[model samples]
Target chain A: DAGITQSPRHKVTETGTPVTLRCHQTENHRYMYWYRQDPGHGLRLIHYSYGVKDTDKGEVSDGYSVSRSKTEDFLLTLESATSSQTSVYFCATSITSYNEQFFGPGTRLTVL
Target chain B: AQTVTQSQPEMSVQEAETVTLSCTYDTSESDYYLFWYKQPPSRQMILVIRQEAYKQQNATENRFSVNFQKAAKSFSLKISDSQLGDAAMYFCAYVNFGNEKLTFGTGTRLTIIP
Candidate 1:
């Protein structure tokens, strides 16, 4: 569990609405990442934060924005939810070099 | 950009048998690292094994091991005496030197038949 928790384990929202997924970690790790998992595509990096207010876009950054205002909290927002954005979101924390990544249980989002 | 490839979309092995999941990556860095992660139906990503690009010896963790070929840019995971617990989607990952981000493969769904 690594003291990581994700809010709204499952969500059902209508299209064109705004949605935000929260990831909170007690480990106070320096690195936090947001990834989306799809059936054939596997896991695609959405965004990541190296530190507070320091973040970078990943391979599939479109329609996704992230914020790391605090060391333990990282937020992912989908400005306008769409059906295409429906996927299982996972938050992972690591110390260094991706040797071991602690992932939250995961959040399944559905856009109706 | 580094890319990890898991060519086997699906594989199956009988109980107590051995199975190998193939994974290949493209990276120019000399000091990168490779990893194998397993995601069961529970959806929790668990680390299975890891290999350092600088080390020549294969990494073994319990019944899980990795065959790492640095020159061929290939790192494969082998499971001996496969058990039903080994049934899951296995992902191969790569991390470049000095970078903490990991790139993952599409994953190979491994099934352990009774």
Candidate 2:
């Protein structure tokens, strides 16, 4: 798991609700990323952070928001969870952009 | 944008045999990196191997080796002496130099038969 931990390994929530997933790392890597994995589609980046308070959108950023207030913590929030947002989420960290990334075990979210 | 393609949706191999999974990528940049990640039934993404575009030598780790064709824009992973534990979903990924985003392929599911 590379010193990374994601809270709420499994969660079931109703649609139109709010859900937030937390990613914490001990490696103190400068780059952190949040990705979602679904059937037929590989892991798709939802958001990433370069440094504390520095965040950027990824390919599938809709209905998702991210916040990074600390180097070791990156949070992904779904303001209004929808059925389409139900998927397994993974968090990854890297010392540098060009270096290999270390992934967390992953968090599975289900929206009904 | 860089894109990775894994042509094989599923593959199977006999125990102690070998299998090769195909992957092709499209990238305009000359400086980049390619990686193979394994996701077993546990759904944990594990780094199988990596290859730098600048390196001519293929990267290898124990039973895992890659056939990298820089000119052909192809990178394939070969697993020798296949074991049941090796059965998993393999994903090919690409990352450009100085970029933080990783583009991944759909993945190839591998099954090892005893």
Candidate 3:
């Protein structure tokens, strides 16, 4: 059942606390992405990995960091959580030609 | 950087009626893709339909279809015989041939009236 699994489906943490959201995929697709969805902003890319050990920042990568050590794992870390960073996080994977991204059920994070 | 825009903030349609959601984008690249994604209350982003920029024919999936006006950079979603399940936030997205990141619009909240 690991098409794409995001850990702790929901999380509530205090400001300044370090929090990490994990995205695990069974698919061996080469591209993986992390995005945050908010009310009026829609979904904005945070970071993405083209392959293991290769990563790049998205438009909203200020407070977020991501790592892909293995083909199946992409981890997003909030070094210090902030209330403004609290939003629904989604992980997606895709093949080379088709841009259709399969998104995982989002992880709802709330910062206090 | 490409930008997607969904001008309508919210719209309503009576059950079984048709509704169209508008989306426009700005990009210099000619080869790219457009998409419509539905986010239900559960917050799961589901792909409604997609259109390739090079294609002249619109793409359809069941009750959902897209009207792609490439020259105009307008990609709109038309939901025929709208249902209650269609009530959700619809987002228009764009992805270039080389870039995997999907740029999304602000999204339109569609309400299905009884």
Candidate 4:
């Protein structure tokens, strides 16, 4: 919610295929994050961007890459998605490090 | 490294009853933030409550309140007058000062019985 939108809410893709998930925010939050949710793992951060063209890896950055071309859009790309990458992905935005981060509706990606 | 732990994997509470979900964290930093997020069947992550490490007073929102024991390094969520809508998986998360990245715990699945 909170003016955050994630595209392709549900997608079923084949193994080794490239996939990109988009997150757009109108709130102009200064920070954006990409995370994945698995059954046993609550939510693991894949990557984050503090400003346009400024990105950094997170705890689970392997097999995933991110880019922030504008203040409103953050993209997550899986070069070659594997079955292990199948999970629900969430995008969150925060105005600052101390502010409450707002989350967008999650995107469920299934790799076959 | 900071880690959050939710010991209870599953819990059930009858309608109109109270339920408490426990969460604890391990962190060396004194200044940080704690949060509880709820994910229902719809798969939307909702912020239920939050507590700041420096604040001594517990944070309360409607029927949702938190028991924050900073000395004990514990933060637990209490929900009163539970309803069917309260059935969801709750996650406890932590973030250190100056860092927006969050570390989350394995969730606790809550079931509401009529």
The number of the candidate with the highest DockQ is: 2
Model 3 local distance difference test score: 0.92
Error of 1 at B101 (Å): 2.4
Best by lDDT: 2
Ranking by TM-score: 2, 1, 4, 3
Candidate 2 on A41-93: residue-level lDDT in tens?
99999999999999999999999999999998999999999999999999999
Write candidate 2's Cα lDDT for B1-114 as tens digits: 888899899999999999999999998899999999999999888999989999999999999999999999999999999999999999999999988899999999999999
Return the clash pairs for model 4, or none. none
**For every candidate, how close is chain A to the native chain A in TM-score?**
0.97, 0.98, 0.96, 0.97
Candidate 4: Cα lDDT at A20: 98
By summed lDDT, the worst window of 10 consecutive residues in model 3 chain A runs over A93-102
Candidate 1: tens digits of C-alpha lDDT, residues B1-101: 98889999999999999999999999879998888999998999998998888999999999999999888999999999999999999999989878767
Regions more than 4 Å wrong, model 3: none
Taking every candidate in turn, the Cα RMSD to the unseen true structure, in Å, is 0.9, 0.8, 1.4, 1.0
lDDT per residue (tens digit) for residues B1-114 in model 4: 899999999999999999999999999898999999999998888899888888899999999999999989899999999999999999999998987688999999999999
Name the top TM-score candidate: 2
Write the candidate numbers in order of decreasing lDDT: 2, 4, 1, 3
Clashing residue pairs in candidate 1 are none
Model 4 per-residue lDDT tens digits across residues A1-112: 4799999899999999999999999998989999999988899999999999999999999999999999999999999999999999999999876667888999999999
